[model samples]
Target: MSTKPSLAVVERLYLADAMGAPLQARLRLSLCAGQGIVGDRHAGRRDWPGQNLTLVEAEEIENYCLSRSRPIDLALTRRNIVTRGVRLNSLVGRRFRIGDCLLYGIERCEPCRNLGQRLADETFDVPAVIHYWTGRGGLRADVLSDGAIRAGDKLEIVDTSGGLA
Candidate 1:
């Protein structure tokens, strides 16, 4: 068995008013178990249980920008949290704590056509973006405990093996 300790911090947080709306930055947000961010478009939506929260690596965004020779806004990714210094893929099926909230990593948050559409612009290359982001899109989580999370919060890996033991 191995332990993946807390190795990252929440660099940013965002929420959208609706499905097609632009993401707005927030200093903090409330989360409820089995539900998403309060006031978020997807909150209380049963269709995506694991999507209670979405997270993206800050490194992935930096890489995407470097590869494309430009900067991409964090909001365009549609992820609720922009994190730094953690291997999010390694947390799949794992339990992690973000600030006061406890969450279960459900699956990888893959880039979709809608994401591409939202990010499309004269300087944005959809295919290239998708290709670059492939497995690095981020993680979708199911809130296991209700609490408030804020920017600068640390992600602590509570169960590294994701209960495989």
Candidate 2:
């Protein structure tokens, strides 16, 4: 059977401990990007294509951050994509096709001290998750087609070459 990976829109997107310019997000959660369209808000540099986490990571981080009264919440993050049914870690080295765009599985979304602070508990295995997912957190893909991507868009695993690597 094929791994049916699907995407969804969550009620919230969050940015933990972000103290710089406000990021822009869409309530739609997913957006369609066509040729010449900007695929990521922060695309370029080492953090190209940006980092995105699954709902699971967000929930875990939210609980940890909220307990510590940290300032990481949906209102703060403007993530363009919120995925469901797809584990951020499991996608490592895999190839994902969303609409006409393609992405390479890169890494996981790790929790930072900012996340711990946002939780207000300051006591969680934030480091462990981070360490495990570093460089393997979130799938980072170079724009393949720049097609319009929107919330509820379907993600297809076109290639399984990720596991071999």
**Candidate 1 ranges with C-alpha deviation above 4 Å:** 1-6, 120-125, 163-165
Candidate 2 C-alpha error for residue 90, in Å: 1.4
Local accuracy by lDDT, each model: 0.85, 0.44
Highest-scoring model, lDDT: 1
Tens digit per residue, CA lDDT, model 2, 1-165: 798545432333333224344645543333222212243344322443334322233443354346556765543223334455555565666766765566555544444555434332234465654543343323333444444455445667777665422
lDDT of 1 by residue, 46-155 (tens): 78647688999998887776766766677658899999989888888999999999999888888887777655668776776576677999998899999999999999
Query: On a 0 to 100 scale, what is the lDDT of residue 69 in model 2?
Result: 67
Per-prediction TM-score? 0.88, 0.54
Error of 1 at 127 (Å): 3.5
